[model samples]
Target: MKIKHLTRALILGALLSITGAMSSCEKQTQTQAQAQDGQYVKKGEGALSNVMLATIQSAAYTPTLPTKATIIESPSNVLSPRTENDNQNQINAAITNLSNSGGGTVLLGSGIFRIKSPIILKSNVRLKGGGQDVSIIKRDESWTNVEGRGMLESGGYIEDLTISDLSIDGNRPESYRMSNQFPLFGIEITIDNGGTTRNNRVYITNVKIVNTGMGCHIKHTNNVILKGNYIVGNGTLASSTHSLPTFFHNVYLRSIDKAWVYGTNYFKDSPGGNGLNITHLTNLTVEDNIMTGNNFRGIRLGGSSSIILVRGNTVSSNTDFGIGLAYDETGQPQNFSIIDNTVNNNDNNGIYIPNNTKNGEVQGNSLSGNSPLNIKKGTNLTNVSCQAN
Candidate 1:
């Protein structure tokens, strides 16, 4: 019958050419997961110059966040001159005599304690110190750039606070800004009427914050727990001079609802902003942290943040964008979970999921030479369910 119908039309044209090449490779992987619009490729933008970007544009403090978190609502700590010494009047009279004889623990000894101010804290209290390199709290080279809030500072709506070990030396930043406060951090939990106030169960352990402008600013905190701490924040003599650059940070959570930055060690990085700049957060959990060499961005979950979880981190060589779901002070930006990270060689773009970021989940990351390891500008109505990154 005509050679058996020419062998059934050559096996139906090789099964319709393998179903149109597997549906054109699933529509070219959903158009490369939304990457278009010139695929956001600008490789690198580091080693800031231009006089370090004009000392970060001579800080008109244009929204690189931070500093709405004021202190001095007077739960304690605000004896102004930034806390006039005698080690801040014997640690604010031992944390107001163990929080009015209700709470306890204020033991702090073992050398150097020349504080220039801020050691006020209350609510349950428990500011133990001894060895995080022998309890040193230096900071009083005639305290310049000193406004107030941190070197250990606090305000209203307090909770069961606990700051252990200790080794703060925020000997930097604020090289200016006075009257309108904001320029100081080394554990500054806030309040003083800048609105939003929660402040609950805060616990920071094995502390060791150095050269600071910011090394912890837990604002509007709630169930916060930054364990195994050891921030460097911005060194190199305040990032080669001024540019408190994008408002300093080695940790600057804001409007936080729940947090747990585990195994922290954002050391030797942050020439200024971001090494963990979290904002308007919710159920956050940044585990196994070790955010590396930053100049800006080594883990910055933006304002409209959602159920976030950046796991097994080691966001390397930051020059910006190693882990950024950034952009927003409100709305969009949802369930993120950049997993098994080791976002390597970041000169830029190891992970930069922007564009209406929705149900995100970039998996098993161990990306290499990140001038571009992943930059999914989400669509398909903000999917972002990528795999084996």
Candidate 2:
């Protein structure tokens, strides 16, 4: 009996030891699984990771304007001075000297200064004024031949300048009497020549441009913001013999890579003109603008391509179509969006998108006092919602 009791105690002890070993193995397996699942904390930060984080943070902020600016003030004379009779050379010399030194502001004091020749602007220069009503730059018709030569030329980086509160009158003899008689405007601002420097990152605000063959001309530029400016076509009263209709465009943009024209007012009493003429551009945004009584189309985008956004603009009393877009020779206008615009009282169709255009979205545009058809002859048009008001 004693031997049997001793054997039962030994068997119970062996069973208990086996159960304890199994529990220890299970705990070890759980710890190994957690390690395999990447549950460890990081010890040090990486250089590449920190750099990427810093780049993202910096990109979120708006860039600040340049610190130094040059001021160009007009001679103190209430009456307009002729380019030949007045100290025109002195003024041009001052402008050239300041721009060559570095980019700074050129202040125009209160007066009317008649400019016979086009004034050139170097890189990083700002032409400012005391007040829009106080300062004026009038063009002499005799010097109109220099229209395309550019009133301001930029060599290096041109950015962050306010050009407003001044009037540019283009009714002088040198400006008006042209042999070619083409649609040439008063001021030409351009950025070209494959320079590393970008051109015309300028803010044109609250200026009145009157009697100009074309008010403001921009070419080969980027990030040009035009706001709160009044652009009017030259009236027929300027010409007596020809009886030719007034040919003026409030703003003409040609071959610009990326541009925006917003919150501007354009009006023309005579016919055969455009409010805004855009040609050969990409990534253009036109919004919150008013175009009225234009003889030609309100906004004409000629042979442009890639990501054109026209939104929240008002087109009224235009003799031709309100908005017109044409494909380039290569048929390249792929993506265009026209949304939330009020187009009324146009003689022709409200919106005309030709068959050559592809991948367009026309939505939430209102049409009134004209034909019911807002869109015409376009393929691959999706999500288009047009309603008559």
Best prediction by TM-score: 2
| Candidate 2, 1-389: lDDT as tens digits | 99668757755654454344323311111111011221332334321211111000111111222222223433222233344733345456655666566545566777777666666655554565556567777765556465344333343345554466677766534444332253345556766666354565666777777665667777766667677777776322233244334444667777766676776555443245678877777777788888878767788877655567777889878777888786667555546667667888777777777664556555446666644444454555433322211
Candidate lDDT (C-alpha), each:
0.65, 0.57
For model 1, how does the per-residue alpha-carbon lDDT over 255-350 read when each residue is reduced to its tens digit? 877787777555548665678888788778787888888776788888776777777888888887888877664764577777777777777677
Best by lDDT: 1
Candidate 2: segments with Cα more than 4 A from true spot: 1-88, 141-162, 172-184, 191-200, 234-248, 267-271, 371-374, 378-389
Candidate 2, residue 362: how far the Cα is off, in Å? 1.5
RMSD of each: 17.8, 19.4
Worst 10 residues of 2 by lDDT: 52-61
Estimate candidate 2's RMSD in Å: 19.4
